[model samples]
Target: MGRHDFFSKYAPRPGRLRFAVSRVAVLALVIIVLGWIAISILIAPPPSNEPLATVPLESVPTSSQSAKGSASPSGPRVTVHVVGAVKKPGVYELPEGSRITDAVKSAGGLAEDAHPELVNLAAKLIDGQQIILPGDSTQSQNPNLPAPSNNAKISINTADAQTLQELPGIGPALAERIIDFRTENGPFSSVEELDAVSGIGPAMLEKLADLVVP
Candidate 1:
């Protein structure tokens, strides 16, 4: 008999029906196992996100503002006169912590004949100080005068008109006025007393401190 005929013939029998039922059950179990495997593959967790890039909001630092708000003290500033043998011999305004070298640089550097050994370049400057550069021949003649003394100090109380002229912003006329004011008034109680004189104000006095005598 043909296979189709054989299967049809056996399809209605109790034993054949039992065998067909068992085969159907086996197919259903296999289908269920395959669906469960597909579901497990689809639902697996994705890879971690640890290596992504992040950006910052601030700008990089530069030389201009290396240290902001770290300014030096803001009290009175000293002014000094650097005359003779300097490139730009004039009055220079300096802070309290300035050195003789700083004043020389501000005066446009020393002249060719300026004896570098004469003055202590590292010496700290004071208010109302006068720094005179000697001539080449004079420096050679007087080696002692080159370096100021350890006790080298300015006497503001007794400075003459010529010495007072060495102050910054004080020309011959202003120098004369300073002397006259001191003569009329008693010895200055404070350096600020110079502002009491006519034509000499806070601005001018501030610039005169490093180079002034009395």
Candidate 2:
């Protein structure tokens, strides 16, 4: 075949040749559009079914934090010495509002010969307080005579004239004067108040300091 001979022999008209060329161009454009759509579908990301993340607005306290916040405060405590006719006598620690009876119980209760009626068991305990339980020996003794031992200090506010005379330098006249002073002025608040009495001087007070308590 020679150049341009095949188209001239098959079509024979210029109008037919132009119509075929337009039909071929339209089919090529349609194929290019379909290929472009397939390429976009393959490269694009897929749709997701998972939910988005979010933060809470308020926080809740943990177990330790809740326990700390709800905890109650404890009451105060006091330490005292329990002596004399209890089953076991020693220093003990107790709550602030504890009474003498409670201290006795803490010391294993009163001994067989202890005279519980002589002591006010309901009295409230204080820090550094000393409790002395009188026994059968003490109950049998006469109140006018001095105690066998000087280790126990006499209470000036509660002691009678005979008991007051048990202290050093205190005679019948001085004991009467101490009783008169306390009777006239009311109970002594402190041992130092004994100086207010006419006969008791600084030297006498110094000597009685360790032997008596107000």
Candidate 3:
């Protein structure tokens, strides 16, 4: 049968209320689906809190850290003597890594006319390194002056502690010890014997060979 013919023949009577009931049933199904969706959303737990990601801003230099963190815990402490044209001259205690300038500063700074050129200020101070401040007039010339050669010449055999301290790498304490050794043990048989003294060694003897005498 044609759709129009069928609908006309089976159309609900107004008093029967069949069309109204069918519309109400579809509306109920839509409301039920909406309610179920809303309940599912409200009843589910909120998503778990997540840990934050982090990154370091900077890292320390490995070389520098290792350098500062020395393998050995500590080392010997030594004192060096500073004398002559310095403002105040005397013995100064120093750690192994201290420098010549550090010792000079401890002795109260260089004299007004100290010869800075004669000594290496940056040299790493070894145990017993004496730093001397030379006289202002050392560079001058006068007939009354002793031979220029004499001024340049340093005699370890007869020179006092102050003079001996002027030698490279020799400090006032070592100079005094040398003098004492000379007094007690007799003049060094050869410059090499200086190593037999407590603080000196092959390296120091090499530095002193040119400056020492029989």
Candidate 4:
């Protein structure tokens, strides 16, 4: 028999109607769920995956530390003379903040006969300061004159920075400069060469003329 004629002649089963209704309901529910998901995605998008910028603690310097580093002063050197019983008495270039002990070391340290009690080793050195050791009088031009004597005229070229300071108006700084000039350009040929040193003007040269020997 034909399907239309069979269906029309036979009564439909009660279970078939229920099965069709349940299938339709399930499909409608799935469609509704899918639409809801699509709407949510359109409303709220995913966040970007970029990282935040951050400086490491170790890389950053503290305010006090940076200030301390910048606070230090450099350069600005001064000259000082170490004389008397030092092993090698001479003029020495030193930092502006240097002390007498530092200048003494540069002059090759004190000799055994040095009178450590006379001079202040801990004192701060100045541009033209001299350290005269009491027992070092043997260095005087005339050994027979006695120790601690300055009566003999100092030889400009042969004298150390300390001895040169004996000249009028000549200090440790000027004495050092003179020695440095002498070392670089050989000994001063005559007292007239004193003019080459910046601080020694005509009047100073005249005063030093009778005192120093080339």
Q: Highest TM-score, which number?
A: 2
Model 4: per-residue Cα lDDT over 47-165, one tens digit each:
87889878776766689889988896878888766666788988889998787778888988888876554344665565665555435554454242223324444545556667677
lDDT by residue (tens digit), candidate 2, 1-214 = 9868977687548787799899999999999999999999999899787887788778688999999989987689878787667899999999888888899999999988776654457656656666666666543553322233436667665455666777899999998888778667765656789999988999999998878765
Off by over 4 Å in 4: 1-6, 9-58, 79-93, 97-101, 106-108, 115-214
Looking at model 4, which ten-residue stretch has the lowest summed lDDT? 142-151
Clashing residue pairs in candidate 2 are none
Candidates in order have lDDT scores of 0.65, 0.75, 0.67, 0.70
Q: Pick the candidate with the highest lDDT.
A: 2
159-179: candidate 1 lDDT, tens digit per residue: 545555655666788766766
Q: Which stretches of candidate 1 lie over 4 Å from their true place?
A: 1-75, 137-214
lDDT of 3: 0.67
TM-score of every model versus the real structure: 0.33, 0.37, 0.32, 0.36
Deviation in Å, model 1, residue 125 alpha carbon? 0.7
RMSD in order of candidates: 12.5, 12.1, 12.3, 9.9
TM match of model 4 to true structure: 0.36
lDDT of residue 144 for candidate 1: 27
In model 2, the runs with Cα more than 4 Å from the true position are 1-69, 137-214
Clashes of each: 10, 0, 1, 3
